[model samples]
Target: MRYTITGGAGFIGSHLAKALVSKGHSVDVIDNLSTGSMSNLDDIKNKISFHKTDILDADSLEGIIQNTDGIFHHAALTSVPESFTRQQEYENVNVNGTENIFKIAKKLHVKVVFASSSSVYGDTKTIPTKESHKLDPINPYGITKLNAEQLATKYLQFFDVVGLRYYNVYGDTMPGAGVISKFYYCIQNNMPLEIDGDGKQLRDFVYIDDVVNATISSMEKNTGSCFINVGSGVATSILELANLFLKYSGSASKIIFKQQDKGNVMTSQADILFAKQLLGWKPQTTLEDWIKNLYKS
Candidate 1:
């Protein structure tokens, strides 16, 4: 199969691209290098098609969709605070870029698997957010992702579409240096770990491999018009995560508590039972185990 992965050089996208190549499938990648990096594809530079283009450009979508079998739309402005600063940019990339993908997919009849985010749940009181739970995003990033999910669902009637509501995915993926990467960097430098508020706010940190597997399952199943949460279904507080990192890295860094940001959600965890039932996907890496592996000396 020939696959087109938007943001292919990005953290999750790069991993997914490599997985497809290992499975004997041809891959064409489109990335603008905004938050993505080509270095992530250094190992397979010559094995896949690479394009430095943004999805917002009119020709970007049409050019890639013409000859692709499936699309993994991983392109987006993902920073929560960044979205607040650049609302229009976020809208263009996340919302408009998504529309472009769907439009092109409709024209070419290609299957799509979109990367949604847990931020769509916002500050809702729900302990473990489910797909059926009410969505109330407090930030522009989450709003854009929710809109993208809706558009994907609308596009599903015309073509195969699956929206993955990814939880707090973290790992040492080169292009996707998320919060986990920040933690690692801080620990490695012996910098004080900054804890927002009491540091008791919970988050579901799903490993990159688990997310990749769930995405592949969604693609292979051709799951249409469904929003699935890809996560470990366990919540670990920020302070707890820092301690785990410290233990894993054998670092002697002290922790500092900071006031929580006004709009930040206090807690977030996912209900991944649906993913397990639908795609036979459940996160295999435990929190402590993942931290240890990442920080193994």
Candidate 2:
């Protein structure tokens, strides 16, 4: 089998690309290196074709992605605060770039499993947010993701599309990594861990391996057109996460609280029952286990 992974030099996309190669599938990696790094693909660089092209370049994308069986679309600008400052750029990359992928997929008659986000359900009242939950994104980044999902739906009639609404995904080598990586970095540098607000904000942190597995499964299985939440289905508070880092790293780094950024979602938790039913997937790694393993290694 042949597969194309956009943003394949980035965190989740790189992991997904390596997984495909390990499974004996021919993989083509497309990354502009804007946010993705070549070092992420160093281990398996020789085994796959690397295309240094932006997704917005339809001619280049179509040329490279022509013969692929499917596409794993992970290219996007994902920073919330950054999105607010550069709304048009965020829309251009996150939304317009996605439309380009869908257009190419439609032309090629290939299946597409794209990355969506839990940010779409920004600060929802629902404790365990489901795929059916209302989408009221609080930031430009989230709004672009939601718009991409809408594009997927629009293109679904022409080809198979699966949008995975990823929660806070963390693992080794994450690009623009979120809270987990920040805590780990602080611990490593013996710097104080800064917590935004009261440090009580809740989040569902899914490990990268689980997310990659679910992404591959969504493409391999005949799940049809649908959006599924990919997450550990567990909510961990920021304070607890900080304490975990302190406990595991054996660092005496003080955790200091600061004003939370505007447009930040107070809580996010994914109801992954739909993923389990559709993709036969469940998160196998827990935050505690991952942090503990990090120290062990």
Candidate 3:
């Protein structure tokens, strides 16, 4: 099978591209290098068709995605606070870029597995939120992801679509974009571990491999068009994560409490039981072990 992965040089996208290649599939990658890096694809550079193009450009999408067997749309502006200040850019990339792929995919008649987000769950009081949970995003980033998901629904009449609401994903080569990556960097540098608010807020940190697996599962023929949560189904507080980093890295740096940032979710957990039943997928890595491996001396 031949595959086209948007943002294939990104953290998750690069991993997905490699996974597909390992399975003996041909891959074509389209990425603008906005937040993505080509170095991420170093291991499989020879195995993929790489294009340094923006997802919002329909002409580029038309050229690259044509004749592709499947599409894994991982392109987006993922920053929560960044979206607040750059709402227009977020809309163009996350919403419009998604639309571009769907339009092209419709013409080509291909399956699409796009990356939705768990942030769409917002500050709702629900813990272990299901796919059917009420979505009330308080931030622009979440809103844009939600918009993309909604746009996906409209494109379903043309072709098969699956949207996976990814939880906090962290792993090797992950940039300093998420909490785990930031903490990992600070721990390695012997810098103070910054904690927002009381650090009591909980998050579901799913491993990148697991996320890629769940994403691949959604693209399977057995699973039709639908939205699902890809998460570990376990909650870990911010403080707990920081402490684990300190323990793993042997960092004696004291933790500093900082004012909590805006557009942040206080707690987030996902109900992944349906993902197992539908996609035959489950998170394979445990939090502590993955962390320890990442920080192992």
- Per TM-score, the best of the predicted structures is 2
lDDT of 3: 0.90
* Alpha-carbon shift of residue 148 in model 3 (angstroms): 0.8
- In angstroms, the error of model 3 at 232 is 0.6
lDDT-superior candidate, 1 or 3: 3
Give one digit per residue, the lDDT tens place, for model 1 in 45-70: 89999988889996856865688888
Question: What is the Cα-based lDDT of residue 157 in candidate 1?
Answer: 78
TM-score of each candidate structure, all chains considered together: 0.96, 0.98, 0.98
Query: What is the per-residue lDDT of model 3 for residues 1-297, given as tens digits with 9 covering 90 to 100?
Result: 999999899999999999999999999999999889989999999989999999888996797778888999998889998898999999999999999999998999999999999988898688889999998998999999999999998989989999989988888888786888888778778789899999999999999999988987787656778999999999999999999988887889889999999999998999998998998888889999987887565
Clashes of each: 0, 0, 0
Off by over 4 Å in 1: 174-177
Q: What are the RMSD figures for all models against the true structure?
A: 1.4, 0.9, 1.0
Q: Ten-residue segment with the worst summed lDDT in candidate 1? A: 171-180
User: How much lDDT does each candidate structure score?
Assistant: 0.86, 0.93, 0.90
lDDT of model 3 at position 256: 96
Q: For model 2, where is the 10-residue window of minimal lDDT?
A: 172-181
Task: Point out where model 3 deviates above 4 Å.
Answer: none
Q: For residues 1-297, could you state the per-residue lDDT of candidate 2 as single tens digits?
A: 999999999999999999999999999999999999999999999999999999889888888888999999999889998999999999999989999999999999999999999999989887899999999999999999999999988999999999999999998898545888888888989999999999989999999999999999999999999999999999999999999989988889999999999989988889999999988999999999999988985
Q: Give, for candidate 3, the lowest lDDT window spanning 10 residues.
A: 215-224
